[model samples]
Target: MRRAIAAAMSRSKREIPHYYLEHSIDISKAQDWLQAHNAERTPEQRLLLGALLVRAAALTLKQTPELNGYYTDGRFDPSSSVHIGMAINIRGGGLVVPALLDADQASLEQLMERLKDLTGRARHGGLRSSEMSAATVTLTSLGDRGVDSVLGVIFPPQVAILGFGTPVLRPWITDTGSVEARPVLRVTLAADHRVSDGHLGARFLRELTRKLQSPESL
Candidate 1:
């Protein structure tokens, strides 16, 4: 596993030209929706914010398709399906990303349930080979660890990786010029510069923010 990871990182560093974009999104609506949704569920069955972020990314990719594919053989190949590779940290140490198949088609509740199942299976070394290799794009979050932001490395063959930082309460100016404290989340995307430009990256972030703010759609 160590050799495989090292080889993959070495290939990514040597081959991919990575460009990063960062944005802070107001997730107040998403938070409110989550809190209310969880009120009727058991503690073990409640949703995690990371799952919502994944759902949002999946939805964003439907519009910004350039960021959701692989780069290989000196060209970019866009994927027709959106299988999100969710990064999960093992209990003892190390990390693994298991693909959540057809994330864009799942309902919010179904996505949360699938995420819980994936994380549990990944930590216990129960992931299938197809799950390990079928990811069209990846999502990593260090928010639970209290990191403010991250500039992630692009995992190769895959053209991009989306990262989420810890959510914090910050003063936000409303359209009416009133300042209010809102829960803001920092999101970053690292993409292959050969396949996409900063303009597309910005558009992707905007769509992601829009999806996150309208959590009802996820």
Candidate 2:
């Protein structure tokens, strides 16, 4: 632990102590909306995206509260905050995730603002130690590296990790019955065998996709 922290230098090494959960999401419309969302992105998108993911994870995790918190000394500790650890790729090939502050309860807008601020700080090497240690769940977005879908290892103590894939252009049949290009993302989910079954994992993926397809893109 000390070595890892030293490697971080001023940076904080998140010490998570529980098993993990992993989720991969495929969004067919992600590419299209990301382009538009980028054009009009306000730090607001940060909260909106975080809220969407929190809500998505909550929907599934709430189904089994036993998996919602830390599992230490061979036991689970339930958590009230749906704090989400968001993974970010900054310079130097170091992947860091600053927990979205109180994400489970934050309003959409609030989540976005905090996400933007935390991410900015992380990039500049300004993240505080507390910020790194607070996450209850980790969400990873690989920028453009996620092409389709990726199954990620669950970060420890969180019980889950969500990965995002790069959007790809695929052929889709339009309403006019003509083949057209469509943006689609592949999704994957990994769950702790002790806490999640294939059925639960599938259900989570279904809900995530529904959110992405909702009026507000997840």
Candidate 3:
């Protein structure tokens, strides 16, 4: 497993011209919405913040299609569907990203259920080949470990990886010019320079933030 990871990283570093863009997303509204929404559900059926982030990214990719595809054979191949790789760590060791096929078409409730199932199966080594291979883009997060930010390497064949950090309380100004502490999530995008640029990356992040702010639509 280590050798395979090392080889993939080596190829990623050698072949992909990587560029990174980071954004601080205000997730206060999303958090409030999640809490209220979860309060009405059973504990096992509740939504996770990570799942919400994945949904947001998936929806954003629908509009910014360039960031949701592969770079191979000296060309960029755009996928018609959005298959997001949700990175999950194994119980004892290692990690895997099982693809959530057509995530953009799923409702928030459906997405949460699928994400829970995928992570559970991933830790138990129950993922199928299609789940492992169909990822058009990847989403990674270190929120549980409290990492501030992550600058991920672009996984080969795929052109981009979106990373999320721990959501922290930060001072924010409201529309009425009032200051308050809000939950801010730091998001980073690492993409193949051959397929995208900083402008597109920033736009994707902005769209993602907009989606998160309106959790009801997710």
Candidate 4:
């Protein structure tokens, strides 16, 4: 697994003209909404912040097709469906990224359930072939590792990858001009320069932020 990863990442860096962008998103509203929403539910019925991030990215990708597709044979082909590759680490060895097929269509609760199942399967084996190869884009996070941010390499064929960092309490200025400590998530996007530019990437991040801020809409 390590050998395979090294080869892919080496190819990604050598062939893909990578461009990166980072955004500091204030997720106070979303966090608060999630807290309130999960308060009445049983522990097993509650949701996770990662699911919300994935759902937002999947929906945002629908509007930003250039960032969600394959760049092969010197050409780019955009996918109509959004298959989000979730990066899951194995217990003692490597990692596996399995796609949550048609991620944009799933609800928050559905995404949470699917993510749990996928993560378990990825660690224990039994991942489907389609899940292994059908991803249009990938999402990875180091939040559990307590990292401030991460800059990921673009996986081959796919044009982009998104990374999320740990949610930390940062000083933020509110709409009313008061300062408060809010949970801020740092998001990074690594895209193939052959298919898109920094401007488009910035727009994609903005849309993702909008989707995240309006948790009820997602």
Give the candidate number with the greatest lDDT: 4
Residue 99 lDDT, candidate 3, scale 0-100: 98
Sorted on TM-score, best first, the list reads 4, 3, 1, 2
Candidates 1 and 2 compared by TM-score, better number: 1
Show where candidate 2 strays beyond 4 Å: 1-67, 172-180
The list of candidate 1 runs beyond 4 A from truth reads none
Residue-level error in angstroms, candidate 4, position 108: 0.7
| Candidate 2 vs candidate 3, lDDT winner | 3
Q: Can you give the TM-score per candidate against the true fold?
A: 0.95, 0.70, 0.97, 0.98
lDDT of 4 by residue, 1-218 (tens): 89999999999999999999999999988999999999999999999999899999999999999998899898999999999998899988887889999999999999999999999899888799999999999999999999999999988999999999999999999999999999999999999999999999999999999989999998
In candidate 3, how many Å is residue 178 off?
2.4
Residue 190 of model 4: what lDDT?
95
Question: What lDDT tens digits, residue by residue, belong to model 2 across residues 37-77?
Answer: 55766653423343455555554555555445664565667
lDDT (tens digit, per residue) of candidate 1 on 51-167: 789888998987777988888888889999999998888986667888999999998779988998899899888999999999999999999899999887778899999999999
lDDT (Cα atoms) of all candidates against the true structure:
0.89, 0.60, 0.90, 0.95
**lDDT, model 1:** 0.89
Superior candidate under lDDT, 2 versus 4 = 4
Full ranking by lDDT? 4, 3, 1, 2
Residue 4's lDDT within candidate 4 is 99
